[model samples]
Target: MNSKSELIKFEEGISLESGDNLSSFELMIETYGDLNDSKTNAVLVCHAFSGNHHVAGKKSNGEIGWWDEIVGPNKAIDTNKYFVVCCNNLGGCSGSSGPSSINPTTGKIYGKDFPIVSVKDWVNSQNMLTERLGIPRWLFVVGGSLGGMQALEWSIAYPEKILKAGIFAAAAKSSTQNIAMNEVGRESIRKDPNFNNGDYIELGVKPKNGLKTARMLGHITYLSEENMDLRFGRKFQDSNSKVDGKVDFEVENYLQYKGEKFTENFDANSYILMTKAMDGYDASKNFKNLDEALSSVSSELLIVGFDSDWLYPPERGKEIQLAAMNNNIRSSYITLDGRQGHDSFLFASEKYEEIIQDFVGS
Candidate 1:
C-alpha cells in the first residue's frame, strides 16, 4: 500500500482531436506497487467524471482516494501483483493541465479557451504517458462510467497496446436521454450569474452556487429511485422545518450535501468539458456499425452493468458484448444485481469484487 503521486510534462506538445496543439501540458498520476523489470505487469485505471488520479491510498491531507476500496493490496485490482497507474485527464482540475492551468501565451488560465477534448484525445495523452513511463503495453485498461468509455476506446484505438479491458456501467455511445441530462446540468451552471461564462476564475470568483446545483443534478442520475427510497424515503430532514418548505426531505438534504462537497474540489469549467466529452463519445462513430467498429478490438474484454442502472442500462452492456462476439473477440458480459444504479461499480460489494478479481486474474 505504498502509493505515490507525480506530475509528468509532455514538452513536445499534444495535438488534440479539435485540431489544436497544446504547447505543453502535464498529467498528475498516482502509482502503486513496483513496475517489473519487464514492464509488462502494468494496469492502467481510468477515472470517471469528477474523479482524478488519486485512485487509491491516502493523499498528503490523509484523505482517501475515490477508489481506495477496490484498488489496494489484496483488493480486486491487487496492487501487490500489478503496477497500477491512474492519471488525472488533461482537462481535469485535479493537479492536471486544464481550464484552471496557466496558458503559456496569455499567462492566464485557459478557462473558456480550453480546447474541446474527446475520449480519443484522452487515450492519445495516456499513450504518451505510457511511453514516458517505459511501459510496453498495459496488461489491462479498466474503468467505469465515463472512464469505461475511455477503456472501450483504448481497445479500438490501440488494439496492439492492450491485452485486456474491463468496462463497467457504460455504453458504446451516449443515448439521447444521456445527452439531455448533461445539457440540463450544463445549463444550470451557465445560467448562474456567477459562472461568468466560464471565466469565473479570472473574475476572482467561483460559481459555487451554479456548480453545486449542477452537481446535485448529476448526483440524482448516479443513484436509482429504489436506492433513494431505501436510503431516505420520504423522511424529513428536520420535522420542525417542514412548515417552511426549506430542505424538508431527507433526500434533498443528502443531495444538497453532496453538491456542496463537490463544488469544494471540482472546477466548474472542467465539469462542462468532461460532460461534453461524454456527449461526444461514440465508439462506433467511424465505422458503418458497432460490430464493424468492434472488429478491430483485439483485447480480451469484460463488460459489467448494474440491473438498476437506467442511465446506462444493462442492455447497453449487452450491446457491446454482442458486437464483440460478432467480431470474434473474447468477451464476457455480466449484469450485477443491485439497486445502486450507475454508482454500483464504485461500491465494495463482495460479488462485484469477485467479478473483477476473476476477470483480471484470468
Candidate 2:
C-alpha cells in the first residue's frame, strides 16, 4: 500500500473537555491508499497506548508499521479499496503536541503543565483533522484496546460522521483493577530520580528506569498465562549456569529486553498522561448506564473480545454489545478463543480476518 505521514498544524487549536484551550496544536497523521472521488470510502484507524500514526506499510526509515499485518493491499482492512487514516493522538509524544511539545504561550515544553486530555478531547481534535481532509464522514472507524475506546467515542460524539465502529479488546469503562495498574505505572515514573518531577527533558535526562519498570509491568498484563508458559515455560536463560539470583529465567530476560527497548522510543511523561486518560474514560459516566450512553449512537458496532483476555475479557465486550442492542442499534459480539490475552486482536488476526472483512464489506 502507498502510505505517507504528514504533520498538519491547526492555528485555531482546540478547547479541551476540561475547559482549557490550546492556542495552536499539530497532529501527526499517516494515510494509506487513495481517497475515492466521493470521499465516502475513508476509514479511520485509531491507535492504542504507546502507538503512533504509523499504522501500516513501511516508513521512510525502513521500519514496518504496527498494524501492517492487518492493513495492506487486499488485507483485512483492504487498503486497495479504502483509504485508511491513523493519527498520533493530540497529547501523544510521537510528533503531536503533548508534554514534549513546546507550549505556544510559554515558549517552553508543556511538561506537567500540559492540560489533561480525555478520550472525548481526542475525538474533538480528530474531527478537526477529518474536516481538514474534507472527509464529510468515515465509512468506518476501527481500533483495538485504547484505540477501540476512541472508536467508541467517535460514534458517540459525532454519530453523523461514522457509519460503523470496530471495538476490539476494549471496554466501555476502565475496570477498577485496570485503574490500579495504571496508577502503579504512573507512580513508577514519578518515583524515578531522573524523572525530576516531569521536567527531565530540560535536565537532559530521562526516566528510563521508571519507564522501563512500568513497561515491564504492563507487558505482563498483555499476555496470557498460557502464552507465557508456551513461550518461556520456566526455561533458564542459560542452561550452563546455575541460579545465582541474577535473572535465571528466560522470561526475566525477555521482559527486561522489552522494557529496555520501550524506554528508548517512548516518553515517560507521555506514558503517564496516556494511561491517566485511559483510566478516566467511562462512557456510561454521563448517562444512567451503558445502554443510555449508547442510546444516541447511530453507528453499528462490531465488538470482539478475547476469551483469555483478563485485562478486558469477553464479558466486557458483551456488555457493550448488549447495551447497543438495548438501544435498538445493530451490534455483533465475538468471543475469540486465544492464548495471546489482550493482544490477541493483533497476534491472532488471521483467526478473525474474514469476520472483519465481511463486517466492513456489509
Candidate 3:
C-alpha cells in the first residue's frame, strides 16, 4: 500500500450504461494495497451515508474517512493482507456524482433534479467499477449500517461474484419502522426554511440550521438508553446550568455538537435524497421468499447484529440467519452486546474486527 493518493478512473468504455443519461457514471475510487494477478484478493468496503472514497486513509485535502479507526493498513479490513477499495456511492456528495455535482446539460448543480436512486442502481455502478479495475470477484463485501444494506444487496444481486461477505446492523428488507425513521429525518430537512424546495444552494443559503436539527434528531436514533445514561446521565454541560442558558444536559449538548459538526460538510438536499432512496428499498419485492433471496447468493455470509441496537435490532439478523439456514447457505451469526446502538458498528466495540477478520479468513 502506498501513502500517496492514486486516482483509479473507470473509463466510459467499460462503465455502466446510464439510464438517466448517456454520460458514464464515474466511480471516484481509492485502493489500498495491490490487486493480485487473479484479482481475487479484492475486498470492497462499502461505506455508509456521509462516507467517501477516502475510506481507510487521508486524502490530499487532509480530510479522512468516517471510519478511519478501521479499514487501515493493519486494521480490521487489513489493507496489508488484502487489496481494499471503497468508492463513494452514486448520488453521494463525497467525490462521487450527486446533487452537488455539476450537470453538463444545465450548467448548474444537479440539486433536486438528480434522478431518484435505488439500492440496485448503486450496486450496478459498483459492479461496473469493480470490473473496470480488472477485479474478477471480491474476497468479500463487508459494511455496517447503510453500508451493511449495500453489502446485503451485493450478495443478493451477484452472490456468485463474492467469496465471503458480512452484513452488520442491516435487514434483508428495510423494516417499516426503519423506513418511517428515515422519513422523519427527511422531513426535518425538507421542512427547513433554508431548504427552499431543495434549491437553497442557488439562493446563496445553505440549510445549515435545519440540517443540524435533522442531524441532532438522527443522533438520538444512533444511541441506546444505557449508553446515553452512562455517557450523559443528567450531567450538566457547563457549571453555570442556567445563565440565561439552554441545552444544559450533556446528551443535549452532545447531540447539538454532532448536528453542528455534521452540517459543516453535509448538504441538506443530499441527506433527504439518500434517506428517501433507503426508505424505498425492499428486497422482498424481487424474491419469492426471504430464503429464495438467500439462495441466490453463493458466498459465505457473516450476519452480525448488536443486541442493544434498537434501529435494526438483533431479531432482524436472526431472521436473516434463519433464511440462510433454510437455503443451506454457509453462514454464521454474532450478536455483540453494546449500548452504542446502531452506530456501534462504526466505533470500536468488542472484537468486531476480529469477527470479520476470522470470517474472511475462513
List the candidate numbers ranked by lDDT, top first: 1, 2, 3
Worst 10 residues of 2 by lDDT: 239-248
TM-score of each: 0.97, 0.97, 0.92
Cα misplacement distance, residue 355 of candidate 2 (Å): 0.8
lDDT per residue as tens, model 2, 162-234: 9999999999988999999988998999999999989889888999999999999999998999999999998
lDDT, candidate 2, at 281: 93
Task: Residues 279-351, candidate 1: write the lDDT tens digits.
Answer: 9999988899999889889999999999999989999999999999998999999999878888988887888
Cα lDDT of model 3 overall? 0.78
Candidate 2 all-Cα RMSD: 1.9
* lDDT at position 78, candidate 2: 93
The residue-level lDDT of candidate 1 at 261 comes to: 87
Per-residue error for 330 in candidate 2, Å, reads 0.6
Candidate 2: count the clashes: 0
After superposing candidate 2 on the true structure, give the runs of residues whose Cα lies further than 4 Å from its correct spot. Answer: 239-245
Model 1 residue runs over 4 Å out of place are 239-245
- TM-score of the candidate numbered 1? 0.97
Residue pairs whose backbone atoms clash in candidate 1: none
Instruction: Select the stronger candidate by lDDT from 2 and 3.
Output: 2
